[model samples]
Target: MSARSLASPQSAGEQKKKLADSLIKKFNKKFNGPLNNPHLSSIIVAEVGKLLQKAKISPGDLEQVEAKISREAVSESSAVLRNEDVRLRKIKAEMSSKGGLPAALLSKEDRKILPKELKKTIASPKKKPAARVSVNMLENTVRARNAQLDKQKAKHTSVFSSLGMVGPATPDSDAGNILVGAKSLPLDQAVDPWSVLIMHDVKKYEDERKQREEQKRLQREQWKRELDDQVKINERKKKEAAMEEVKYAEEEQDQLRVADIQEKKKKEAKMMINTKLKEERAKTVAELQEQKRRQLEEQKEEEKSEVRRMEAEIARAERRQQRKREEEAERAKRLQEENKEQRKMREEERKKKHRMDLEYAASQARMLDDLERRRLEALGKIKEKMKTIEVMGDTLGHSILEKEEEDERRAEMWRQAYEKKQLKVCFFRVCWCRGACNVCVEAVRDRGGEMEKVN
Candidate 1:
């Protein structure tokens, strides 16, 4: 071991010794600790915790030193025992050969039996039994618990049975045993499984059959009652409907006679209004045609005046061109050799200027070509834009048509609603007229009766 580990209080070896000593001490004190010490498990755990705390170690640290202390303890005990055995054997040999202090040594039987027993104890392996709960014991405990519950249930059931009330219960094997025990019959007969099963099946079938018959009888009676009720209702509804139809027909005929007379008067008025409107439309058309003829004559006279002005302008332009050529020829003859040297210099400048002009003309041609190319590209983009605009216009027109159709549909719906309202008004008017006619008829009948009595 390193000096540092040996010297340190919290080292592995020291921690193991502390843990083992603490365990041994707890065991020595009747397996009790500072607490009530009810069990060995708690004591061992407490000792382990206390030693680990003192050594500043963890359970993981204990793993390395777990077997060390136990192994050392065993070896220490075996060495002490071996030394004692050698001393004893030497003393026995001395007693045999020299007869020195024979009384101080053990007798032959004690010596042989002690060594043989010790050898046997040392040679035999120590068994570390695995701790487990016994399955048979657990099963017995469960069975006893079940029996207790069954007894309590039986007691409660017996009390309720006397009062003719029973709680719900599920059948199990134990229930049959209980029934057999309660019944006063021979054990063999009462415990017969087949007899129990047959009785259960018979009762089930009888109950089910009784329920089915009761249900079917109730359903047949309900159906017959419903059929009778429906027939009576149909007869009553038919009588009410026929009376209403007859009353409605009488009222409709009277209204139709009144509507016919009123319609004839309205048609005569509409025809007179339509003739007036047609006459007014024809007068406006004739006025518009006269104004158009006057405007066409004015436009023809203005065109003739413009043509005359254009012809005068063409004659003036031709005369100006003739004068310009005459002026150029006279100026050239007068200034021809007035500065011959200067003229030569002027000629050289003229040649350079002409070359420059030629170069400028070539550049202008290239620029014109570039402009033409740009114009072509622009024309293509304009065509594309036109196509897009056309499509957009078509879509806009379609949307407008759809909107107009929707507006028309809404207007038609409104017209239908107005017509329905008018029909309702007419129906109410007809009902009012019917009520007045009934009152008048009753009065007339009373007058006729009075006249007969007077006569």
Candidate 2:
């Protein structure tokens, strides 16, 4: 039987031991460190052993617990790493969003809200409108002209009064004159209510024009402030982007190093596994060869045993045949002696029977002779009667003659029938006697032959 067939199934402890051994080998080959550093395999193995001993756990249960812990640890670690990667990626995206080109470096197309035409207009340099003519100066010039007109009118009214050529002036006329004067005077100097209303309208118009110019000036200043802020923000973003690029390059280098290490470890592991498989296959082949040799030996022994058994059986069969032949010879001798006495008695009986048959044959021959003589005498009597009938047939009438002839013929026929019957009986009796004599003679000859053999 094979060792595997003889042994029980491997226990958890044994499996664990095998796993540990494999792990130790893998670690010894995989770990790369300072020459003075302790081997990773020894440290890991010792730590795990110490932990398991402290737990005082059974191997079977420990295996299950270890497997569960390993799965959970791997899952948790992977989840954490995945979350960290996601967070880092989100931060990188935010940083990229914050970083942008400064206005000085940006193209018109890059401006988010500004149209190309507007950007061009803004870029083109133009002289500021020389400080807008102040509305107050225009108001002052209008007041001075109104004062000179009022003075010339007053002087002309006085000269007309002195010449006494004044016509009847009613109150209505005076009111009309005051209205005309109010229309020409400045708002501050005017006494008429209409003059004040007209002056209020002129001032309101001037104030509205000044308000529009101030709004335009404020808009220009706001645009300048926004552009400055944008430039500062762009500069900051550029600096941050440069820093991020350097950080990303360093991370990529680290990842490449890690990947190279992992690849080397995988190659080493694959080589170790291949070597182990080859060793196992060779060991299995040797075991199979051993089993085959054992089977061949067993077959050869069985064949030799079978040959011995067959030879023994053949010998027994031959002996049985020899014994059977000897028994048959003895029985045949006894039967021969018994047959000798039987043959003597049979000879005596056959001789007596032959004598009786001879006597019977002699009597039968005498009887046959007697019957022949009687038959011949009857035929002679029949012939004589036929001659007599023939003689009487001539004397009788023709009919009577015919009757006699028929009678005679009938009588002759009857006589001939009787002779034939008697001859047949005699012939049969003679044949029977001859046959009995022949049988007795043959029996007597056979007995004589047996007697000679016995002598």
Q: So what's the TM-score on candidate 2?
A: 0.23
Tens digits of lDDT, candidate 2, 1-455:
12232233557568456655764454333321111124333454664465334323443333333333323322332343344344434433443465422222233223332223324434432332222223344565557655764665565552223212233333322323433322333334435433454577668756865875675566445544554454454455445435544553564466456546756865886687578658866976896699679868966885686587976677576775687589669867876886687688657856865886687557645744663464345335434533553454343333334544654564465345435653212111222122233332333353453211110
Q: How many clashes in each structure?
A: 0, 0
What's the lDDT for all of these models? 0.45, 0.45
**Which candidate number has the best TM-score?**
2
Q: How far is candidate 1 from the true structure (C-alpha RMSD, Å)?
A: 58.4
Per-prediction TM-score, please? 0.17, 0.23
TM-score of 1: 0.17
Over 4 Å off in model 2, which ranges?
Answer: 1-176, 179-215, 238-260, 283-455
Indicate the worst ten consecutive residues by lDDT in candidate 2.
424-433
Candidate 1 residue 175 Cα shift, in angstroms, is 12
Candidate 2: Cα lDDT at 101: 23
Residue-by-residue lDDT tens digits, candidate 1, 1-455: 22234346556676567646765564434212212224444445545655445535542234223223322322333343344445555544554465333121334332332322232322332332222223334455556745764676676543223212234433433433334324344323334333455566557656855875675466445433433453454455445435544543464455456546756865875687578658856976896698679758966875676577777667676675687578668756654654465567657856865886687557645744663464345335434533653564455444445544654564465346535653212111222122232332333353453211110
- Each model's RMSD to truth, in Å? 58.4, 73.4
